[model samples]
Target: MKQNKLIGLGVATMAAFLLLSVNTAEAARTDMVDVSNHNGYMNVSDWTGMRDKYGVKSMVTKISEGTFYKDYTAANNIATAKQAGIYQNGYHFARYKTAAQAESEANYAATLAKQDGLPNNAVLVTDVEAAEQQYTPLTTNDYNNFIFMSTVQKYGYRTDIYTSGSWMNNIMTVKPGTGWIASYPYVVGDKQWYTGNHAWQFSSTQNFAGTTAVGNFDVSQLNDDFYTGGQNTKPVNPVTPPVTNNNQVANQDYAQTGTFTANTTVNVRSGVANNAPIVATYAPGQSLNYNHIYIVNGVVKGRYTSYSGQTRYASMGYIPGGSFGKRSAVSNSRTYTVRYGDSFWSIANRLGINMNSLAAKNGKTINSIIYPNQQLMY
Candidate 1:
């Protein structure tokens, strides 16, 4: 009887130990470090150090902006990151004045990636932000997104849209696809927006000095499963289906435009041009009129609607500050403090200014030396 009792006790002890191990693993999985652009410009050696020290599993880096593409640094960054054994992806900051312009930019980016050989775990992302002026046409923005996504799909690359939840739900329609939501919630009511998302930017001021990747704002965090074969898995194809109702046309509503029903199951593609393939599908009755529509390669693609209820179009022929305030003369008065790993080119890209302009603003050449915490006016 004592022998049997001893056996039973051993089994119970083993079960308890297993449970404890599982709980410990779950706790460990909760901790993640996000090395986004907030780290400024890190060279290959710098990134490799972070990967080795912090156990960084993944990274997202800026690749291009509007028509201006990053120099060899982008490819160098990706290659260095891969060598350091980290998953790497690229993002483009949208700066389209029209749908056509956006489409052109997307195509250019795809070509660059193809020419340079996309990284193994690459995810082509669209970073959408508001234009300088509020009155810019909504159609232009929508079409620009469409073409950008389309181009990405055409290149046989995964795609994702990175934006805030409010922008996704209110300003833009969330088609059937994943999103990198920038909703930082340190506590209750700190949420930036409320919506379903694949990854969440938990905080912008993470302290990583002691841990690893030091001297950078802990600017973002994501779900543990993000880029770990979960919903945040890099999209195999970023394109949505093509708009099926090519023949359906509606008048521009000056007020609130009621949602337009998709006459047939539609494929909402990602790119602005006819390059990328379909990434997701929208069924009949799926609303498109919630936003505005713009012309892309002569076809109308629906876009986000504005507060005035009218669909906006791209300023195709207009010059900057001409009828519409599509362009802004950059103010050379403001100054920015340089951070560790920062380069003039990287700083210029982040500031949305040309390298020469940035140099000129600071009374230095593009190759002028800059140091961490040094202020440069632009």
Candidate 2:
């Protein structure tokens, strides 16, 4: 009976060890890629090749930089990654060192993310690795919390942090968050990275196996909570393409009528596609009266009939350089004193008012020349 009892105890111990090993293997980190305009345009095949060949399970796209720049390739990246069955999120290149600046940047990044179709549940990360932060450092996590809460309260997306190990160790007063931490060991195999982090960017020059991509890429190991629980739950304001027969879209998704004024010269395309022929162009402050608009394939489009009786589309939202224009709206009553080199068109465009209304209120015509300091009501 003593020998039988000894055998039973040994079997029980062996079974417990096997179960522990299996659980560890199951919790092993999955790989991911974070891309920006530097990576150029990734097509469906590029994403698929990364997924199928190198075990890339998710992607983090750079959506905006600071407050002025928007990553033009972000929309395309999100769309193609979704096609390749890769979960998608976004990160903003943070330039904020104060709470106010942090709030502004959060709004800019969140707006761009929504415009680019980043899902509501996907993590919106603030990249805090800029050198400027070192010189003028943020003393507290409160500034970052401003960014985090802005996305949560206003945009309905949670936030994350990405920073170098040096910053995490020496610079930051408080640890940023339980997000992706970057530190290159310059070694091989799955290595442990920062403590209490969901993901670790182990290498910035990882050459994935069998990838046709030319240069080295930034790769991360995600244990959990890196892919929004492995799903993008809510797609924000998705724009479906209109019904088309032979590339000619017949109807828009909705009928939206408004006047869009170009803040800069932007192309009026023949169709909703980016490669469509340029039918016309809007000069700075020139207004286009559009009957309807469509958000197709991540581009906001407006339809107008040209003089030749053909329908033309104008992009009213974000493009490579900037937004084509904005909706023309004047919210307050104001007066303006004309300055040097100011014309009716120039003043109207600058003030976002109607040129005709400006001239009529000032008892002048568009062709009338007025001297500087002339008071005008708008």
Candidate 3:
């Protein structure tokens, strides 16, 4: 079955080995991988292949970040995985500094989860580590954590807290729902800091041989219940797409002004090959425009032109004709903190900005050295 290939905000690898919820051996345990849009584009078939080859059954995908930001691939990833018969959960990368903000973020995550096809019986995780480090009002995180858990519970979904011992001990006082503890030396069962934890993410630098994914994989081991597909062994998220009344125009030539409905795992490729460099990602039900369509050997395909005026392409099966068209125009004209390994070229390329113009806007050269946590206004 195709599982959700969504990953979470960076969780440091686990180092310490403790006991498991059940008495399970540590030597021969299957690991689960978490991925996000940053891990690159992957279709349902790609995720299924990963599961079949690596025995990865459970996943934690990034659905929403804060109250404003939403993962571009959350909808499709959740839908495809649930449809493919895999254990999947959704998480929000929280940026709240107060209890009210945390509650709002929780509601935001739940709303997006519902829109993205996240199952009701699955876990909804709040990534609190980032907010603990970035947000202020030191005495407010405990209340924030409490409100977050309560809000998610109100939505008829279980809440899971993903954080380290330091954050738990230093920042927050109240414990939320279930725990997804992240510490070193990969431990199982009741952790030293938190008593109730379902899984332990051991390492973030490990790579999978069965897959061709770049960068290190965030590796984790699930408790017996989680390894067994959390709550529902046969979790279902079947697609019941609304019936379209538009007449099918067979062999209709692609037009410059034509729009297409993105049906999840939709990639905007720089070229026609499956391995082509991806230009952008679109959520399911998002309406996208294309420059041309290609019919190759009974297969339907379409070309999408990027903001850099580069023509990208994708298979047309997920690119059905639609009247709800909206072209992507990235105008992230706000201050953004520079993250690790971010470069002018990479940022410009990702945001569809002209490289030289982006540098000029920052009052820096195209080759200026960017450092971590440095804010850039574009």
* Per-residue lDDT over 269-289 for candidate 2, one digit per residue giving the tens place of the 0 to 100 score: 888664477778888788766
Between candidates 1 and 2, the lDDT winner: 2
- Candidate 1's residue-wise lDDT over 241-326, tens digit each? 23333443332222222333443444444443323344454464444332333334223344432223233332110000001111
Could you tell which candidate, 1 or 3, scores higher by lDDT?
3
TM-score, each model?
0.45, 0.51, 0.49
Q: Rate the local accuracy (lDDT) of all candidates.
A: 0.48, 0.63, 0.57
lDDT of 3 by residue, 1-378 (tens): 012211323333434331211132333233455666765554565456445434457777788877788888777777766665557787788778777788899999998888888777677887776734445554677667778878988877777777655555555543443566655444332333333556666555544432334555565556546433444322122221222223323343444335566655455556554445566766777755555665332224567555454666654441111111233333436555677878888877765668898889889998888899988876
Off by over 4 Å in 2: 1-30, 173-177, 231-378
Error of 1 at 42 (Å): 3.1
Ranking by TM-score: 2, 3, 1
